[model samples]
Target: MTSTLDDALKRLEMAVGLLEASVSRRLEAENRRGDLETELQLMQDDRARLAVELDSALTRLHRFEAATDDVSRRVRQAIGAVQSVLVQAGQLEPEEG
Candidate 1:
């Protein structure tokens, strides 16, 4: 009877130890998962912010391009007018091309 009681007590102690170890592992895994989730959220937020900045930069670039085109057109028109005036004044020859 004494030997049987001792064996049962040993088995119970081992079972409890195993249960505690399992709980500890589960808690550690949960903590690691939480940390990973937080990191993912931060990455997503950064991606969103960068996307907005990129869009803003692209919009600015397009506006600058449009302004540059308008300026070029105006310059060409001014040059044509000057050439016409010079030709009328007999100061410049018109090109045949």
Candidate 2:
């Protein structure tokens, strides 16, 4: 009977140890999850800031490209008109330098 009681006590002690280990692991996991949530919030804020910057830069780039196109068109027209004038004056022969 004493041997049986000792065995039962030993089993109870092991069960208590297992329970304690399980609770510790659960607490650690909860702490890790909270830290991850904070990190995720920070990342979301950074993404929003970057998105605004990208949109502004794209708008500026588009404006610059439009201005460049306008200037190119004007330059081509001016060159065409100058060529016509030179031909009328016979000073710009296509056969000579």
The models' CA-based lDDT, in order, is 0.99, 0.95
Best candidate per lDDT, number? Answer: 1
| lDDT for each residue of candidate 2 in 28-65, tens digit (9 for 90 to 100) | 99999999999999999999999999999999999999
Model 1 lDDT, full chain set: 0.99
Which stretch of 10 consecutive residues in model 1 shows the poorest summed lDDT? 88-97
**Candidate 2: which pairs clash?**
none
- As a whole number from 0 to 100, the lDDT of residue 35 in candidate 1 is 100
Q: Over the stretch 14-81, how does candidate 1's per-residue lDDT look in tens digits? A: 99999999999999999999999999999999999999999999999999999999999999999999
Cα distance off (Å), candidate 1, residue 88: 2.8
The alpha-carbon deviation from the true structure for residue 11 of candidate 1, after best TM-score superposition, in angstroms, is 1.2
Give the per-residue Cα lDDT of candidate 2 at 60. 100
